[model samples]
Target: MATYSSNDFRPGLKIMFEGEPYAIESSEFVKPGKGQAFARVKMRRLLTGSRVEKTFKSTDSAEGADVVDTNLNYLYNDGEFYHFMHPESFEQFPVEEKTVSDAAKWLQDNAECIVTLWNGRPIAVQPPNFIEAEVVETDPGLKGDTAGTGGKPAKLSTGAVVKVPLFVQEGEVVKVDTRSGEYVSRVK
Candidate 1:
């Protein structure tokens, strides 16, 4: 364990406090007009998915826990584990459905991204920032209506739906903002 001053704290830095693991969310150094500077920190509890805020003297030190992250390629899912292979070493690992959550459903086969590990086990996955998936289905455009004010629903190959311009049609490959589940632009 390493002691890190509040000044050393940064987002995604993992620390152990009271036998639980937490990662820093945000930290701000506040200088009160009459008092010493302190660090206001927000942290996310890894086990419970809860957030906590606390203030510490700027020089206060805490035990820093070790966490690891690696860039990898999503190979495929086995219905149980979403498998990933490291880009450099080709070492592979899998995280289960619950851990990947809705992100797994958003991933296409062989996608490249990052995965975080704690104590040599997968804890979270960072999927690709964006993806281009073909629209599999949607209501047909109104016949000759020419009124484009309203948008139609488009379903992507990942089974996620987005409101697209009236002109988007089935089989069109559209760039998707995976984080927001929104269509960005038509690929072609």
Candidate 2:
């Protein structure tokens, strides 16, 4: 594995710490008036999503994690594991439910997603930033109520609930932000 020096400490960099893989969320350089320079890094554990902070001296270094992200097509979930396949290679694998919890809500059959692997095992999954899903259920929109006002909860085809504008109706398609799980706009 390659090593990353303090100079390489930056967000999105994956490094190994105490036998676990961590993604650096933020890194700030701190130099005291009389001491050497150091880096304060906030990292999130790839496997658990827990965050932690650590300081490293300018001379300190960390091993780069053996992590890779590959695009895969989602197949289905059997109540226990989610299955995915590589489009070209046709390689398939079952990722644990816990590993894909954050992304499960936005997943749709045949959708392309990025799977993050560490040491040949999946540790995280990321859906597309934006997704268009059909509304499956919601209360009727009131007269004169528009999207600019308060929103209501609507269930989507993927079984995820998102707050959408009053004008959005059942069977209508709405764009959503996967990262924040918020409604973006109604699709025409």
Candidate 3:
């Protein structure tokens, strides 16, 4: 296995700590005037999605984790697991609900997603940054409400609700930012 030193700490770097894989969310080097310099790291556990902070001395090093991110197509969910397949290879992987996390809200059949694997097992799933989904339910747009000023909550076909512009009507396909769950624009 490879190893990473404190100097190499950076966001998205995967390392093994306490026998578990953690992806570094942020790393800051602190050099005080009193004693030694250390790196403060904020990382998220691969399996649990929990965040933790750790301090490492300048010379400290940690083993590199066997983490890989692959492009996969979203399949159907079987209640217990969400299935995904490689576009070319057609190899399928079943991921747990906890591993899919918040990305489940944006997932649709045949949607492209990034699946993070740790040691050949699915650890996390990430939907595309932007998705176009049809609005399934929302309050009726009032007459002459084309100013796009106020907003109303609209439920999408994928079971995610987001605030849409006043002019947005139900059954319209709208582009959404999955990361922030914000409405982007009405699709043509």
Candidate whose lDDT is highest: 3
Runs in model 1 lying further than 4 Å from the true structure: 34-36, 47-49, 143-149
127, model 2: CA deviation in Å?
A: 1.0
Clashing pairs in 1: none
Clashing pairs in 3: none
Mind giving the per-residue lDDT tens digits that candidate 1 earns over 1-188?
A: 88889988889788886676788999988898997889899998765567999888987888886667788888888888889998889899988777777677578888887777878787777778899999899888877856655688888888788888878889999997888877789997
* Lowest lDDT block of 10, candidate 3: 141-150
Q: Provide TM-scores for the models.
A: 0.84, 0.95, 0.95
lDDT of 3 at 32: 94
Kindly list the per-residue Cα lDDT of model 2 for residues 117-145, writing each as its tens digit: 98789999999889999999999999877
Count clashes in each candidate, considering only residues at least 3 apart in sequence or on different chains: 0, 0, 0
Q: Rank the candidates by TM-score, best first.
A: 2, 3, 1
Model 3 residue runs over 4 Å out of place are 143-149
lDDT of each: 0.82, 0.93, 0.95
Q: Could you list the CA RMSD of all candidates, in the order they appear? A: 2.6, 1.6, 1.8
